[model samples]
Target: MTVPLAATDFHADLDLALRLADAADEQSLPRFDAADLEVSLKADHSHVTDADLATEQAIRDILHAERPDDGILGEEFGAEGVTSRQWIIDPIDGTANFLRGVPLWGTMIALAVDGVPQVGVVSMPALGRRWWASAGDGSWTATSDGARRLSVSTVDSLDEASVSFQSISQWAQAGKTPELLALAERVWRDRAYGDIFSYMLLAEGRIDMVAEFDVKEYDIAAAVPIVREAGGRMTAFDGTETLSALSALATNGILHDSFLSLFRDLPRA
Candidate 1:
C-alpha cells in the first residue's frame, strides 16, 4: 500500500537526503584525484569506480537503518526491496568526469512516492555546490557564499533560449541528430554541458533548457523535483510526466510546449 507523505514528512526526508549527500561527498571527493583510484566498466560500457561503490554503500547503509521499509534503486548496487516509496540514488552522476579530475560530477539522491519524486539532493563537492528540493518546500542551492532559493530562467522562446543537450552523440545514437542540430540553429546558443550539471544550471536560472537521450531513471529522478520546485518543467520527450522515460526534456515552463514541438515529428530511438 502507498501511504502518502505530508509536507513535513517530505521536509524530513529532504534533510536526511542532505545528510546522505554529506557522506557521499566525503567518500567521493577524496577519491576524485587519488593516485590509486580504481576504475571499471559496467555492462552498459559506462565507467564506475571504487568511489561510486563506497559512496552508494554508505548511503544504502543509512537508508537500510533509517527507512528499511522503503525500497531503493541505485546505479551501482541495483534495486532492492519493493515499495511505493523508493529512494533512487546515483552515487556519482559523472564518473567519467570524476575519473578525469573534472569538476562536473555530483551525487544525486531522491525520494519517490508511487514513482513521483518528492525530494531531491544533488551535491557536487568538487565544485563546492549543492542543490535540493522537497515537494511544496521550494528548491534551494548552497555555495561557498551561502544558500539561496532557485528559479528557472524567464526566457520564453527558442530564439532567446540558451540550451544544453548533454551531447551530440546522444542525439546521433537516437537517430535524431538532424533534429537536434536544427533546434540548435533555432536557439540563441547551444552547449554540450552534459550530465546533472545542465539540469542544476536550469534550476539555478543559468540555463533555459536541457534535453538528453540514453538516461536511466536514477540518472534523472533526483533532478525532477529540483527542476519542478524551481519553477521549471520536466517531462519525457513525448510530453509525459514520468521519470522512467528514456529521454528527458526540461525547460522554464513557458517554453516547454515550444520545445516539445521541435521533436513532434522526429523519429526517436
Candidate 2:
C-alpha cells in the first residue's frame, strides 16, 4: 500500500531548505579563504571553487535521502530527477568573490512547484546572515542580532531610488551600456553591489532596485520568493516572470513599472 504524502507543506519544505543551507554553510565556511582551496573553470569560463562543489554535493546528498522524489537543478552538478517539485540550488552564488576572500558570496537554495518558486533560502556564513521565505510566510533574515521580518524599500520614484545593476560590464556585454548608463544617471544612487547580495539588500529594504544580465535559472530562482514575499516585484528585463530569461530586474512593487519603462525601447540580444 502507498501512503499519501503531505500536500505541499511549504513551511515544512522551507524548514528543510534552511537545514540544507546550514549544511551548505558548514561545507563552505571552512573553505571560504583557504589558501589551498582548489579552483577550476566551467565550459562557460566562469570560476568554480572547491567550496562550490562540496556544498552542492552536501545539499544534494541530504535531498537524495530526505526528498527522494523531488527534482534538483544545481549550478555545480547539473539537473537530476524529473518532477513538478524541484529544488534549485546555487551552492556558491558569488564564487569569484568567495575565492578572493570577499564576504559578498552566499549559498542559494529554492523549491519550485510547477516551475513557480515557493520557497527560498540564502545563507551567507561569512557575513553572519541568512534570509529565507516560503509561500504564505513573510520573508525573514537572521543576523547576529536575531531574526526579523524583511521588506523592500518604500521609495517609489526612480529619482529617489537606490539601484544596483550587478555590474556595468554585464550591461555592456549585453549591448545595453547606454541604457544602463542612463539608468544610473536617473536613479538617486547607483552601486555595483553585484550578485545575490544585491537582491538580499533589496529584500531588506536597504536598496530600491536590482537588475542584472547573463543570469541563469539557479542564479535567480532562490531570489524570486524572497523578493516577492518581502513585498517586492521581480521579473525578466522585459517584465515577464521567468527565471530562464537572460536578464533580471527586481524592485519595490511601486517602482517596477517605472523601471521597466526604461528598457521599453531597447532591443534585446
TM-score of each: 0.95, 0.94
Residue-pair clashes per candidate:
0, 0
Name the regions of candidate 1 deviating beyond 4 angstroms: 1-8, 265-269
**What is the per-residue lDDT of model 1 for residues 64-137, given as tens digits with 9 covering 90 to 100?**
99999999999999999974899999999999999999999999999998888889999999988999998888
lDDT of candidate 2 over 170-250, digit per residue (tens): 999998888897898889999999899999999999999999999988999999989998999999998987778878998
TM-score of the candidate numbered 1?
Answer: 0.95
Which residue pairs show backbone clashes in model 2?
none
